[model samples]
Target: MNAPEPSAPGVRPEQEALFSTTAEHYARFRPGLPGPAVQLLAGTLAGRRAPVLLDLGTGTGQVPQALLAAVPRLAHVEAVDVNRAMLVQSRSVLGPLLGGRTLRLVHGSAHSYTAASGTDSVAPDLVTCCRSFHWMDRPAVLAMADRVAAPDATVAIMGDGSLWTHRAGWTRQLRELIQRHLGTARRAGPADAYTAPVRSYEEDLAASPWSDVAEHRCPVPRTWTPQGVVGYLRTTSFANAGLFPDSRHHDVFERDALTLLTALAEEDGPLVEQAEFRVLLARRPGGAR
Candidate 1:
């Protein structure tokens, strides 16, 4: 099927399929949830009975899985993504966890999701746009989120590995060199600043002037073997297929990534992949400003 016209501008066309087509690997290799982030979300949303949770851009349902595990009592979770492949992976992952009818998955873009139409008319108590937030038309997503969320509902935007800690000596510098040679479009080298912090969730929430808004940060330490590292990068929004049509570049990137990993291992290096996720939980303002 052809790509749908984006709900508006600013949405990347391939972002939808990039992770989806590689759904199995993504689900298999993507890092599992960090304890702090999940605990923070669970604590913030304590004591809600079967509240509806909307998982936006829920590729392979990792974030949703975490949410479900954290809030198993939810009435239902509605997970929407533009990738059917991703939805398939999600079903495989979330099928058993859901209590028969407690889970709903949709193939659609986050910008187009509407709580007042079709199967989503029931507003959600929480809407989460994990890692995929940057791929969205920010303005359009925020507007739609505002419309669909229940009063006092929370919107959480989260991405892991936004910060790269220099726990592994020489890794950061090596990454820079590799990234410099590969360029952004070329997937054939280390991703320098690949996981650098970009947008600030606090700023976004503050700018929106959301009522009862708060920001929380969690340090999620992750470990990956060399092969796992490669697979993990392949699952990224940046590493989407077709971005590097050049076979040579793709070959070189794989080679260099492995070489770097080997050297790190020789040095008895454990890649201390320190990542931080920020959650901007905001309730819809009551009665205007």
Candidate 2:
């Protein structure tokens, strides 16, 4: 596979330097796949015989843990991450469920890690990447997935963009208040503010070595208390806890997120929104295409 491109401008440095430092907080704050999303992913692949799984950039094992409930017959599961600290934390969270069979956690970069030298097996029956797909170089990663994945294997990627900012009117205003307080440029929409520059599912899958590709979209909803929202932001890449030598920026981000949540909290009901996620699936070619 070709070398992964340098992260787009400011994104690379912040993602690498920041997330590892705040690994624990990130693991706690990062959202897990809702039941429906997991079910949808499982439904597509359940027919496969004895599927071995590889979850790329499996920070804290959220994706894998969710998958356990949906696809219980998992023969083998391997998770790879760039940050060793994240893998360690994932081991703690994931060890119990995968007791008898050792949970495979590899410390490596997804952009370049060849499956042959890296994993005991050269190709897995299934390969998955969650939110971290945007962090790696897309072309190289897709090529790597194509190379390392088994013939007839299905590769999947899923992301829930604009997760926190899904509420329309109140969400829009709350995000505005936070940006103003943080003294950042005002964004067009709450989702726009945190959006990352990555290839669309259609574009990336079309360019890869897959024979047939399909897109599945699901609205995976989850409720967040006022406190949960604040806790969630603490684990974000934009918080830049590591980028800044001091913790002041983190404090600022937390405070602003709290202010927004507090203002929106209702008398009896919790703040909630319709969180939508997209799953892109591609099947590796069975023979020379």
Candidate 3:
């Protein structure tokens, strides 16, 4: 029953600002969890009836939204995020699903959020952190999960590589074009830069309370048109339209990116992005951390 704290230590001001402004684009273009991944998480709760889920860094409620659609036994979801705009976008998209089930949207970081103080607040059967786990303090969040998770809870960390990391031929060309217009270096939020992780999520989880981890990967093939590629770029942190130096520059970049995609698609068919979506499940040992 502790009060929620301020932002966690891992939160960067620039990253927060970047995500806060791109809610609409994010909700529109970012892909949801794959069906197999959702099934794998839900499978961990086979006997639990009406399971409750705690989704940390629930950007636009994508994980919960997809789970609710896939897992009918889910009764409630506590969606937590630091960005208000992203939560707003979540509410807008998840409106219909909120009818019969309980969906509580909390404004807080993953390491600090808890269900509202009351006897009714249930310990979650599944704790999920989707693509937003990279932005969190892994140890702190895992410790927090240890405190709040149910005896048989499973902590699911899921993500697919972003467009920036994809190695498709057209994607490489597109990245080069972006670098030409912006700079050779990757652009993150204003005044912020991207760095490769010193430690992997697997390493971080291995050191946490939930160390008995199992990984599941699925091949998620995505096809995109030129316009779809442009839309997806606007949602990414590095290539967000807002990150451009000026409106004119943003427009020019978009135009050029579209042109590149169009040419690639003309030579081939729809630009297909081959991505592997991975989910790492860490369960509490013997019904306890």
Best by TM-score: 3
How many clashing residue pairs, candidate 3?
Answer: 0
Ranking by TM-score: 3, 2, 1
> How would you encode candidate 3's per-residue C-alpha lDDT over 39-149 as one tens digit per residue?
897787687788999999888888888878877878888888887778788887777876578788777778877667655888999999988788777888999999998
* Over 4 Å off, model 2: 1-15, 44-49, 116-122, 163-167, 181-195, 243-245, 267-269, 285-289
Query: How much lDDT does candidate 1 score?
Result: 0.65
Total clashing pairs for each candidate: 3, 0, 0
Deviating ranges (above 4 Å) for candidate 3: 1-12
Model 2 TM: 0.80
Each prediction's Cα lDDT score? 0.65, 0.66, 0.82
Per-residue lDDT of 215 in model 3: 90
Range of the 10 consecutive residues with the lowest summed lDDT in candidate 1? 1-10
Clashing pairs in 2: none
Which tens-of-lDDT digit does each residue in 1-289 have in candidate 1?
A: 1222224233345545455436778877777667777776676567776678888888888877887788767667788887777877888888877765466666677887754344345677778887777666666777787777777677777775421233455456445544554453424112222333366655555556354576777876766677776666567544433345476776677667777876786687776666666776676666221
Candidate 2 lDDT over residue span 1-289, tens digit each: 1122232222343345546565787667677787766876676566765567788888888887887657777666778777666777888877777744446676667766554344366357777898878767777878877777777677788888654346666567656655554446533222224455565767777888864777788876667787776666556554334433358765776677676677677643667777778887777655322
- Error (Å) of candidate 2 at residue 134 is 1.4
